[model samples]
Target: MRGSFLYIFGGIMDYRKTVIDKLKEVDSIKDIDIESILEIPKDSSMGDFSFPCFRLASVFRKSPDAIANEIAAVIKTDLNIKKIEVVKGYLNFFINKSKMMEETFEKIFSLKERYGFSYIGEKKNVIVEFSSPNIAKPFHIGHLCSTVIGNSLANIYEALGYHVIKVNHLGDWGTQFGKLMVAYENWGDDEKLKEEPIKELLRIYVKFHDEAEENPSLEEQARYRFKLLEDGCEKETQLWEYFRTMSLKEFEKIYRRLNISFDSYAGEQFYSDKMPEVISLLEEKGLLVDSQNAKVVNLDDYDMPPCLIVKSDGASIYATRDIAAAIYRVRNYHFDKNLYIVGTPQALHFKQFFKVLELMGYPWSSDCRHIGFGLVKFKDKKLATRKGDVINLEEVLDESVARTLDIMKQSASEVDDYTKTSEIVGIGAIIFTFLKKTRERDLIFSWEDTLNFEGETGPYVQYSYSRAKSILRKANFNENTPYDCDYLKEEVEIDLLSKLSKFGEMILEAAKRDEPSVIARYAVNISQTFNSFYNANRVIVEDKNVMNARLNLVYAFSIVIKNALALLGIEVVEIM
Candidate 1:
């Protein structure tokens, strides 16, 4: 395994390879001397490694089939390649199966939970801003997309060995807060506030909206209150602080259940003091221009709409605070990348924001990314908390749990402790349902689909695992018994093993794409394959050798299921 052969094999074996090695392999071709040609086949039956020989036909003065056969012959003689075949002018190489299986399993079992993780992002810092709910507003189904998407992105990056800083970016410094303060002052009730903080706050907010529709002065009053808050009015600041703190206490309960934590709660208010510096930097860069009595950044050159840095009333805008936040994150954390997990509606906002930073002559601004996702729409209508057309996230979680409990009661008659099982099934269902689809797609929230415990659903996967556990328990599998991989030669067994080999690649791909749905999809696939294998072939047979081998496979499946579930922020119980 020296020279071009070794380099090609090395590049194929490990995804992280230098370009020089790949080039060397390409240059070493005897007759053709091609630059590069490689592709992962569309299906497993097409072979693991494929290279198109059509390009080489011109150089070699022969037909593509001739070139493909020549390449196939060379690959067949190579010791690293177990087999080589030519199909439709393409050369396919299948590495030795046993060697690949052993090496993959060794890496997986040795690394355990950290098997798929890598240090490609070592020495890199990434700031992920997400879950930024407005203070005193109800945390509704709409907010769930951002919170989970952002949190999962942070987890994915951290797992890839990046220094991740999670920020809430709370909407604590907006005109809405002013309206809330004024409404509270006008129609404030102490006992009602204590009894139902969010409901009462929302009531006052709705009242302000309704009143502002009739009494135009109330709109101006709200703006004046916001200006005072911006000017560091003592009372306004006090009220903002109280509202933020109280709101966070409620938000924390949901965050705790979701297993999401932030490194900092640096919202708009936190970046207010840095706005002047941002404005000065913009002026120095000659990017700031006065437009309609407001400080604006003209981004026409970048084909983006103008960004308002300051309103006509001399109050800072969200874009200004975001710019300051970006600068502060780079200077303080020395982040290699800053990821903003906002909604797609704010796509233009980020475009202008990043464009402004680029105009300011920051090189790292080019690396800052905005991971935008589609909205979570319900069947009735799109979520609108302002109009009270919203479903509370807390209620969703509660309902998920209750539904799981109902299912558990219908099944599992021998269960003595149903409460614990219900909790696991319920929470698992919610998390899995959320992650089962592509992040870019808008999920139509359906109770029926979420509770459907069949066909690629979360409950189905959990039940498969439970079934495996039940079989293993009944067989009384002895850990001390010796197991051999040779018994794993059946088509079903090989299918499961092949999937197990792909776990590391799956995680790496998921992290790269910033989508946990990849892992969810893989988990479902593995569970289905394993269940099929278990059904077609007896895992706990009377024969000791077969039983031991099957038990080993089952144990391996359990490890993978648990690891994949953990990455998605789900817990897998031993029994369930």
Candidate 2:
């Protein structure tokens, strides 16, 4: 079911491939990887694709235009290449749009849900660790980036035939847990904790810090509690386990709302028992050093602060646990790539630990990646959990759904299931807003931009998809019936078909870049192009062949849009 698209779209995968094959014939550039240099023109008027002649000028000893013309002279028009134009020393090829439409529509109609699936990652393994919120803390807006980005990457990898293990490495072990325990014992309301675990826990946790500011000895008390936890004291361990259990329950509710699931819930505490083995290995490797009554791996030669393995209190630090976890994952999963979708602020920590792994003679340390993202801020204010200045993700999602429902009511749209549709749109709106921009860019949440039905937002994408579905319904599109692509001759129709065909290509690119924004931006582009096609031509035309072609195109668009959104971990509504 999954591999059928390859056989169907085989040679006619895309115009880019055709251009690469055609450009391979030019002797002067035969040594170069033509695919790397081939580029899509920013403006459609420039041509469908362009290759700069600037690089070839040095070899040919000619001006870029002269080289472009020389290359154009030999590469005659083929079945895939309709025409080649030289503009400002660039070789721009206009694709055979009719052939593209025929091949694209056939694959889209035949493969259905499996249209974008590829076999590039066959037999490969990858571990995507994300959405790892601290235990007993609110899952705030700041954590959203890692959650969606990691989930989307896992989805993208699976689409490309990689066995992905999604991990939520919960921050279940830390001094914070000790502080939370102290706060719970001192000021926690058991009734409130049962009613709202995260909220009540966060309240007392914040209060502990506030009081600790006045009572300096509270810090020592928190450390003592943490030492008890480390020493495996029965009471401390039980309380820790209780906190962890409650946190996981709360987290599961949020995960269900987002439609996300994880293969592993292993947190820092999972490595507590495993750390001794790692420290032993480090000691054997002669990597561990003494630094200010702590175990350290000096990285001064690499221009980094020494990675502290064990603190002065003999407690293992995050670096030590991370090293243990990486070793465990490699031995267990044998992952080709182990990606950590964390914040950019922790760049040094990852680099230091990964370097320590390398120094310890682990070659796979190079395969470990730190997929860092920028901060998430509400307007100008940054979200800080410690400061109690954070918005719960559930609150944002609820408001989004409410606003979407209000919008639907105001617009008086046909909503068969108002609750379901509103949730999809509202939740999807927040997810899309995070994904629409580059992950490295700090996100500033905006209500106006997020739920705008007409803007390039989640609702806009969902509505576009629903609109396409509506068109297919009106035209009575049938999957079993044959359709002709010959009648899809209008520019907008061809453009829409062109975008539809790139779905697989887009997925492959997203996988390669480790960026879900590629898929997000592509979805918006497809929606915008689809809208243009719908406005220009009516699908249910008087001409039978034309209507069939247009309807088939609409069906194809709907599938591609839905698949694109799915890759971003956003749900689509058939009617919005």
Candidate 3:
């Protein structure tokens, strides 16, 4: 039954190809590959869809214009395709406006929120690891990209019908914990911690680092403390548990505000007991070797650096824990794909880690993927928490909400729900800002640029939706009212309808590329196109037929905007 449903739903798989399939039935060409035939013309006036025949000219041994004319001739005979023209090696297609609008709008309204979602991934499970912040450290803006981007990718995958497991991968077991423990024992005040948790912890951490520079012995002490912690010292274990529990409470608040929840909160500590088994398997597979008082996996055969799984003191490193984590996930969930939403600096580390896994003869290692993104810097300066130069993520969220509230108060009149609208706009702005560019490119943080309401910003798109909502409210559409698609023959209306048809395609592309920015950009494009239509076409005009059709178009626009925003982890409000 599931297979039959998949086959039926798969007919609408590639929308771009659907347009080609329609063009192929023209009976002029014996064969047609839409991708090779069609080209989106630079100018809007060319047509909604265009096919350039320049490439075909070489095969046919004829002038480009002549081949274009041949295709256009066949297109002209089809009633569904209203107009076809050939100009400079290009065949332009214009659909019958009324039919196109009616059919497209009906399909969109019928699907509703599920319009763009598909079973492309089927039942495949994807494991995503992200937001692996160290315990006892403040969650700063530097960590925002990984958290939001990872969560958004997970959301995108799930929407596309993949079983997504979000793993926090917290930095729970590390030398930093040892240093914190030492600081706590020497000068830490219990009353101060009860009063101010993160602040007091941060002060002690900073003090440890500052003092360590002058006292080299402090470094050895820190390492020995970590060794003791790893050796299962009762006191160290209790302290580590206390720190993790306290820190998670603070982290949960931020995660709730952002609407991000993980299926698994397992961090480095989760794989502690599993590391020995991993080492035993590695040694059995003849992958592990002794290297300078450590258990290392040599990767020179694959032209990669060796990976250290255990230090001289028999403490497991990140590579060891990661290998255990990977093996555990594969066995536990049987995931088809595993995604690590880590930063670019650790790109080499993951490369080495995966290479070692492959050498260990884990065939499923090929299915593992590391989705590395560039750093999020402040004014081109790296945000170093040790140097106390980091911005808090909570502060960024608070400021964005405050700014959005101020804008709503000044511009909007009688906001139906101020709190809801503020949350929507504020969260939407942050998500859009983070996803505005490709993940591979480094972005400099700037509030002025991110919060811009006038241009290609989140608020701009949200405002477009709000504007459509306002029009719908004023139009008071009724179920019995019949819409006249003929009223939507205007240029802006045609353009918007064409843009709306590509929503499903856009979502698929974003999912395939693992980039949410594709959807973000499409939202801006749709909103911009709709705004142009709204400015030129009057919805509540004197003509009842025209008003009803225009209202239907706006209603459809609202649905698309809301759906797109949801995919980006943004909230949509009816009024702001």
Which candidate has the top score in lDDT? 2
lDDT of 2 by residue, 1-576 (tens): 324544535524556667888899888778887777889888877888899988878877899999899889999898888999999899999888788778888778778888878877789899999999998988876678899999999999999889999999989998887898889899999898888898899899989999999997887888889989988999999999988888889888888999999999998999999999999998999888998899999899999999999999888789999999999999999999999999999999999999999999999999999998998766623323344466767767788899899998887567899999999999999889989888889887778779875788999999999998888777677885567878888988888887787788788778788989999999999999989889988888899888888888888888988888999899899888
The global C-alpha lDDT for each of the candidates, from Candidate 1 onward, is: 0.76, 0.87, 0.81
User: Which stretch of 10 consecutive residues in model 1 shows the poorest summed lDDT?
Assistant: 15-24
Cα lDDT of model 1 overall?
0.76
Off by over 4 Å in 2: 1-14, 26-36, 380-387
Candidate 2 lDDT for residue 473: 76
**lDDT for each residue of candidate 1 in 421-519, tens digit (9 for 90 to 100):** 777777778778778888878887676777786777778888877777777778786455566767777877766866786776676688768788998
Q: Each model's RMSD to truth, in Å?
A: 3.6, 2.9, 3.2
Total clashes, candidate 1?
0
Ranking by lDDT: 2, 3, 1
- Residue pairs in steric clash, candidate 1? none
How do the residues 1-576 of candidate 3 rate in per-residue lDDT, one tens digit apiece? 334433434322333344577667766464656656676677777865688887778778999899877766655435455677888988886655566667678777778888767776778999989887878888875567888788888878887789999999998997888899988887788887766567678889989888889887887887888888988999999998888888888889888988889999999999998998999999999988999998899989878788998899787889999999999999999999999988888888989998888888889998888887887766623323344675677767877898889988898467878887888789778878888789888977666666776888888998899899998888777545678788877878877876787677687688778888888899999999999898887789998878888888888889888888888888777777
Candidate 1 wrongly placed segments (more than 4 Å)? 1-36, 77-80, 380-387, 413-416, 475-481
Per-residue lDDT of 416 in model 2:
96
Better of 1 and 2 by TM-score: 2
Q: How close is every model to the real structure, measured as TM-score?
A: 0.91, 0.94, 0.92
The CA lDDT at 76 in model 3 is: 40
Q: Candidate 1 at residue 325, lDDT?
A: 91
